[model samples]
Target: MKITTLTNPRQTILLTSRAGNKDNVMTLDWHTPLSFEPMMYAVSIAKARYSLELVRSSKVFVVNFMSCQFEKEVLYCGRHSGKYIDKFKETSLEREEAETINCPRIKQALGYLECQVQEELEVGDHILFVARVSKAELREKGKRLFHLFADKFTTTEE
Candidate 1:
């Protein structure tokens, strides 16, 4: 049997946002649940990324959990920059207004976590946005898509 050692563990998701009418999406593997009372979550995005700038200015974002059907869209959004192209238009995913935040949520996702930035920490190449969950909705209880080894995408059994 071959055993593999893993250091970091997180399910990559599409962090979508819009700032001043500019909408963008970024792939983020750095995310974790921070609290349960207020339902806080955190995501780390590089300062140079387009989504980071949007989140910084808007102070809000939607964490959309991808499904197995969105593998192509995930890769496209992750590899391409929203500054040059419209990611939403490129992908088949749909967007909807969040209940509490100013950002938009992916309507096709199994669920969404809407948040408002609570704190930001400057970490080496990325800025950690610790946000307080303003609202959450589970449209479907399907499996969640995850990225491993930076390329492979897999789904969890529900």
Candidate 2:
């Protein structure tokens, strides 16, 4: 077993970013709340990821906390790249304008955090974007998707 899988059952999210007319969404589990006073967050993206470029250039993103039912769509976004195809058009997920950031948010998300990038640090193979939660919304309540391993998942106990 890969050591990385030790961090199993992590809550997954869809990160949205837009640069110019291009909007992108990517599946992410590597995120954390940094501070409560300022409402800060951090998400690590691979250096080669297409979404990283969008978030970097735009300095904004939306963290879409997805429901467990959207696992298929989440996996699709993770497998494909926005550079080669339009993820929003391909998936059943609907794109909606975020309240604070320029990026779009998923209409089906349980909640979302509109973030404005405050800093970027290169961490090994990933770039960690530290952002301030400019706005947040809880659209719905449901079991959230959790990634255990490739093609394997779990959900919060209801």
Candidate 3:
């Protein structure tokens, strides 16, 4: 059952933080590691998503690991659009400047991976951003929050 397996996979709300005069954060569910050497990852974002444009123009983003504590913020980011509301200001999620990249990182997250978009492939309603991880930092060594079917939450062992 592809649907069942997909629903059960360890899914984290991948937050892609953009860089610019005004930053934008987008919540993504379709993301995966593409390669291990040099640490490459790919994230699929709908073409209509405002953050997708921001990330494409900047070619850099930060992947923040969402925790259970940020469940509300995560849902808000996914539901709302950056074109209208300022998700960051509305959610009041503190942001810190990333070390290796210009994008901002969610301070509330357990850890973050700063990346630079190396390539992009347009696929259906979404565009896949192939990125190279530039830097990573773990604020706390704890379990990671995840999503499952039926709108359930789970965590992974440390």
Worst 10 residues of 1 by lDDT: 1-10
Candidate 2 — number of clashing residue pairs? 0
Off by over 4 Å in 3: 1-8
Off by over 4 Å in 1: 1-5
Candidate lDDT values, in order: 0.85, 0.93, 0.79
The alpha-carbon RMSD values of the candidates against the true structure, listed in the order shown, are 3.1, 1.0, 2.2
Query: 2 or 3, which is superior by lDDT?
Result: 2
Q: Could you say which candidate leads in TM-score?
A: 2
RMSD of 1: 3.1
What is residue 131's positional error in candidate 1, in angstroms? 0.5
lDDT string for model 1 (29-75, tens) is: 77889899989999989878988889989999999988778888888
- TM-score of structure candidate 3: 0.87
Q: Which sections of candidate 2 miss by over 4 Å?
A: 1-3
What's model 3's lDDT at 97? 86
User: How do the candidates rank by TM-score, highest first?
Assistant: 2, 1, 3
